[model samples]
Target: MKHEKRWAIVSLASIPLVMTLGNSMLIPVLPTIEKKLNISSFQVSMIITLYSIVAIILIPIAGYLSDRIGRKKVIIPSLLIAGMGGIVSGWAAWKMDNPYILILIGRVLQGVGAAGAAPVVMPLVGDMFKSEKEVSKELGVIETSNTFGKVLSPILGSLLAGLVWFLPFFAIPIFCAISILLMLFLVKSPKMKKPVPFKKFFKTIKKIFKKNAKWLIAIFIIGCILMFVLFGVLFYLSTMLEDEHKIEGVKKGLILAIPLASLCIASFVTGKKIEENKVLMKWLTFIGILLSAGSVFAISFTENIYFLISIFFICGMGIGVALPCLDALITEGIEKEERGTITSIYSSMRFIGVASGPPLFVLLMKASHQVMYYTVTGICILAAIIALVGIKPKEIK
Candidate 1:
């Protein structure tokens, strides 16, 4: 990559890193918030859920706008909005006697902003690079940035919250502000052709979907499953560490980072290795899901913290290996004109997984730990089957 493109990639990569920190950083802090607000576990999970649900509803709209306008046009204002949302949540948490409802509202605003920011980066990366090889590599960097944020989130969040319970809430805006500045100063949008009319754009998207439904749906499902399992496992681990093991604060956060660190390294390596190879992408995705499923399945038999952390670390590696492949496939396979919309829809499906994961895990775990593990493992198997059967790379063109 050229020097300018390298900086652009850095700018683009910040969106995911900041966005992941804004969200996942809150995971380790959830139990803290739960106790602070005197709320139920389910209600606390809703903080994550509500943010994602709002994003899920709005992401497609953001994608359509980005397709018609430009990526930066959508992204900058979204960052501003996200930062404002953070301020709202932080203020409410710090001052209000009854802050839960207000905090949820603020998360909804953050969700609105997130709808336009991070999801748009995939297509923007696709827009920025001409070479499929470069695109795959940069997308890997983006995924690595995302997972790295996850690795940092627990420790950072815990560290911040260690000072004050609501400190993590305030930290969101600082992260967003840094990303916005990076985007403004370092990134430039590629020139786009004449915008397609709404009716024609709709028809074109329909046609693309009709033609690529099998693989598209498979990718969509697999993306959703991966997030569902990832977030579900994180929540499980977060609560388990606090309730079962009497761990909290920075210690808990450090423990949480172990699995995510493996994920970060795997994503970085896989992103570099796949390099425009659709066959490799497909097989890696398949194998990654199996690895995740196998590790999750093992959780049913063990309660040892070391064993559990080790299992989650393996699971994180599996997810890390698979995510960039999914990203590259969707970004590379789609036509540039419609890539934003298609990839945004993919992001929305992943958000659906995020929205559902924690509460569903909470419910299932209430029934039985075996039931929760088995259910997630079963979903992973189904995703693997779909990837094997539905994604015919030879037929993508």
Candidate 2:
């Protein structure tokens, strides 16, 4: 990549990196918050869940607005709003006797801001480069940054919270501020000519779906399923490590990051190789999910952490390869004019997965290990079947 292109990717990539830091970083700190506020586990979870619930509702709206006005026009303001949300949550946690409801409100605002920012990135990247290979490469880096954030979130969250229980909350705006500065200065979005008229935009979307709904729906469902299993397993691992294995803080974070690091490496590699090969992308994704299912099945047979870690690492690679393939498939298949809206819907479904994963995992964990792995493996198999049937290599172009 040229200096300009590298700068643009760097700036655009910061959005997801920062947004993830704001959310996933909280996971390790949730127990601390529960203790600090004397809140229940369910209530502490609300602090995380409410953010995704709000994002799910507003992302498509932001997508439409980005298409109408311009990507930067929407993104900058959204970043500022998200930063403000961090300030609100931080202040509440810092000052209030019971910051529970206030923190939830702040997270809700953060979700609103997230709707406009990170979800817009796929469309923005699609608009940036002309070469299919270049888009795939950049998106690979972007996805790597996201998974890298996950790798870091637990350790960072635990570290910050160890110093001050609310430190993680205050850190959100700082992360956003840095990303905003990079975006404002370095990123240059494509100029929008005459946008589709408001009167006809929805009709255009309806028409696009009419023509492409099969693949679109498949992509959406599989994306949701991937995240659902990813987060759910991560949750289960985090708790199992902390509660069962008598691990805590950075030690647990490091152990948790093992699988995620595999995920990051796999996403980067797949993104590079799957460039514009619709057949390769389709089959890689199909095989990745199947591999993930098989790995989950392996975990069903193991009670050992060391063995489970290795198994989870394989599962991470499976999810890693599938994610960017799904992203590329969607971005490449769609028209640029409607990319933001369609991709936003994709992002929303992803958040839906993140939102539902923890609670769903909580419910499933009451069952035996066989039941848990069986259920997750079933979702993975279903995702594989969706790719096999719904995603055609011919449709990728």
Number of the top-ranking candidate, with TM-score as the measure: 1
lDDT of 2 by residue, 201-260 (tens): 888899889888889999999999998888878878877887688777778778888888
- What is the C-alpha local distance difference test score of candidate 2? 0.87
Alpha carbon deviation, residue 33, candidate 1 (Å) = 0.9
How many backbone clashes are present in model 2?
0
Candidate 1 lDDT tens digits, 230-303: 99999999999999999999999999999999999999999999998999999999999999999999999998
Off by over 4 Å in 1: none
What local distance difference test score does each model get?
0.94, 0.87
